[model samples]
Target: MNFVKRAGMSLGARKPRTAALLAIFVVLCTLLLGGFLLQSAAARQEADAQRTVGVDVTVRKKGLTPALADRIGAADPVHRYSPEVPVRAEARGFTPLVADVPAPEGDGAGQREQGPLAVTGVRDLGMLLPFSYGSTKTTEGRGITPEDAGRNVAVIEQRLAAGNHLGVGDTVHARSADGRREVALKIVGIFQDPRRDQPGWAPPHELPGNTLYVPVRTAQTLGTGPAKVTEAVYKVGSPDRAGQLHAAAERILGGGGFDFRVNDKAYRDQVRPVQRVGAFAGLIVWVITLAGALVLGLIVTLQIRERRAELGVLLSLGEKKWKLIGQHAVEVAAVALPAVALAALAGSLAGQHAGDALLGRQGDEPVTAAGAPDTVTAPPAVRVEPAAVGKVAGIGLGISLVSTVVPGLGILRLHPRSLLTDSE
Candidate 1:
């Protein structure tokens, strides 16, 4: 019989077995493809999140000084820089007074007295550490603009405003450490520090408390001499170049009188957790896929053994063993081709759903430790693209062909005459 006819006859005669094997192939292929897609999506998402947050380096100094901050900015390695000088001050003309209210003859009632408030001198609160309080803009009323640096203007927290009943354009008196010098400041704005929620050493404020913003220059003038800056903040050229820029800053400020610190170090430190999770997931998927392939190969081998009798008859009829082997091979190919195609399709859909679950469908929901959100959107359709489908199909086909071909070699040694006589 011609090869084509022989293969067709063999396939037609064992419809049930062929169908069962084809179903097995489909299930195995689907599992492998799904696992691969899930791993790829997870790794890509994690890498993207890490790059977005960038890295941070901190430089600390013995004392606040603008000289060192300027030197770091002028250095080649530093990409961007901002400076801060924090100082304490006391509110003047805001003394606590107790009052006595009219009461019955036997009743004595006196209001408790309040104490003077301590505050900090902030240069440009929003520039170095930009943050907002509820709905208030950090620089709303009048931030520390260059023009305001030398003037007696200030920005205080909302809690301070409420406690003192202070509003924009309200004049308040603040004094230096020795109470030797007092300056009048106009309330230009109100803001909250980002670190207000954190514990440990924090400025004396909770979102709306005693913290205040004044031009760094003005604060220096009010307290110490020479309007110096203790800390610096910079806007980087690009995240990719952050490392190089940081190195440059360190080199420039290494022995300078001040220390440089990056404000975003905490955010950068969070990337480790996301990376660990992604690596663990990838390892698990690979293990499961290899196990499935082994189980599938064993099942295919067993099915071939069960059909040995039929194969022997064909061999006794003067059928070229190679041709008979080809027949069985063709039957497997016919089933496996369509099975893989269907599996690939199913895998693409499964991957899309799994990706959504792992990464989230919302663009604004945080996906990484740095608080960066997953911005990946689902494609309009869940079907695998043609390119990806072709690659996966090629791999599946290769695996199936190998599984079918390797065992066919045993058929070549069977003697049809000996098998027939034994049957009688």
Candidate 2:
């Protein structure tokens, strides 16, 4: 018979065995496809979140001098840095809509309880670090601009605005510790503070509301001259370079009596919980895939055993051992390739859904007018490039061949004469 006819005969003769092998291939393909999909989705989300939020490193001292900030920025290890002075101030005459509990009987009633507000005076507020969350959501008007610095213009928090019925173009009063020289500032913008939920504070909406943004120069005029920055934000080349930059920053600022840190570690810490889930899923996929491979090997081995007599007959008739092996390998590949293709399509859809679910759960606010509350949207379809599919096909074929060959070896070694003579 011709090679095609012989190969077809061999494959057709083992209907049950071929079916079993196909089933196992389907299972393995499913496992691998699912694993790859989930991993790809997670990696994409993490990368996107990192870029969007960026990172922040803080340095605390009695005060920061412009000279120090400039020196740190100039460091060879540093890429770009912004110096910010954070101060607590109270809005005078304007009581926050939220009320503080009355002081206990023994507490000094005369002492003025200061409402906390975070006043960040930066040189170029926009360039130092982009205000990502609150610009368009302004309840009344625009965000702080370079012109606002030293001109007594400030941006207040959203909760503060809600409580006080304050809006853009309204004037708010603030005073330093001396209280003798109070500054009346115009409210140009109202924003949502990203740090509202920081430690020692309740939820942003619940906290006795206090937050404001102003020009760096205006901050100095209000109280302490050229306020010291507690933290600095940097824009580096890439995530891979973050470590090198961190090391460089540490070396430059190590002994300067201030802490030098990177935003990556903090960000990773915050997302550790989600990462752990992804890791666990990967582990499960590995276990399942391995198990599927072993099971497939065993089924192929059994099929080969049942066909031992046929293999012996073929060997005696001058069928080459390599040819027989190749025939069986082609059969497995035929079964596996189709199954993998189907599984990959299904897995890609599932991955897209999973990614959307995760992002939705993360509660990302919508970029909308009137600051409409964010709603979860379905994630885009998972895209697998032609290159990636080719790689996966190669891997699947390799796996199918290896599983078949290793188990078929037992049947390939049978002596043709011995098998033909044995009458069962």
Candidate 3:
């Protein structure tokens, strides 16, 4: 009769042994599929962390010009760059919030009594520390954007706006401390500051409410000499890319007084754990596949020993030795297909829960250490994909083939008479 038909009949006759093999296959396949799912999920989360919670590289020097800042910002690894220039201006018609304590008697005390407002020129207001940290928020109109680079505009604190009966679209005049240069800034936005005035002696400009954000050109106009930024900050996609940014900056700024500080504490606290999980999941996949193959190979070898008489009778009847191996391979494959299906079902049902258990659900607020700002990275969740199922199916087939074919090699050298004597 045909070997395929005989293989089917053999499986039907041995109900208990077939069920045991199916059970083992299901367990092995389920573990392998789970490992694949975890690996996929961890990789997705790591990418998200890299994109949103990357390292911040701060470049500080005495006089970092915007021209030099633009050159360094053009690097391939830098995502964005912000150049800040701080200048003092005395309010023309409105009073700024001041500390309650009396002014100290000193040589510069006369200038301290004036309490000029602190005007900060920025390429992008949203990238500033206070706004980025959520400590300050625009309550009316809009914050200064990159498009307002050369425009004369300002976004002032709401407290200063309300005290002076000012609102958006109103014009505010500011004169430089030297009284040589002045600017008429249109109030485009009003922001809210959570902090209050300090009790100890401090200048009016030092108060949070007296701060003003203006375009880089407007602040530069009030300065005496060449346009220069106080500091420049460049953002990179990940901690690893900080080196690339450093090299780029060196090409522009060179090895001078410019100091580069890289802050990657947030990346370390969040992204590193996800990376480790991905690596561990990959290791688990190889371990389970090798162990499953070894266990199944041993099982097949013992069954071949037990069926020596059956094999000898087949060989004596002029049956081909390759057909005997084919029958064994078919039997194992029959069990493997269903086990893969069962594993797919189980993975779809419990993949997310298992992932959450392994990689704990991350909080909305990124973990910050050593004064690092909170990042906006959202944690990724585990999901089932068709590709993962296909991988499990392929692996299952490989294990089945290796386990059956390696043990069947012993049958080729055995003679029919020797097999009959071994069975007797």
* Candidate 3, 1-424: lDDT as tens digits: 7888898999999999999999999999999999999999888887766665667788887667988888888899987667898887788878877667876777236655443688888877766656655677777888787788878999999889988999999998888766787789999888888988887877777888899989888888876567778788776878779999888888888666568898887678767888888899999999999999999999999999999999999999999999999999999999999999999889889988889877677536543221123444444676668898889889998999999999999999998999999999
Best TM-score among the predictions, by candidate number: 3
For each predicted model, how many residue pairs clash, with residues at least 3 apart or on different chains? 20, 3, 0
How does model 3 score by TM-score?
0.86
For residues 286-312, what per-residue lDDT tens digits would candidate 2 score against the true structure?
776567667767766766666678778
User: What local lDDT does model 1 show for residue 203?
Assistant: 29
Candidate 3, residue 347: lDDT: 88
Summarize candidate 1's per-residue lDDT along 311-379 as a digit string, tens digits: 668776677878866766666677767886897778766767765665454333332221111233332
- Please, what is the whole-model Cα lDDT of each candidate in the order they appear? 0.56, 0.59, 0.82
Q: Which ten residues in a row have the lowest lDDT in candidate 2?
A: 366-375
TM-score for candidate 2: 0.66
Candidates sorted on lDDT, descending: 3, 2, 1
The top-ranked prediction according to lDDT is 3
Quote the lDDT for 336 in model 3: 94
lDDT score, candidate 3: 0.82
Span of 10 residues, lowest total lDDT, candidate 1: 107-116
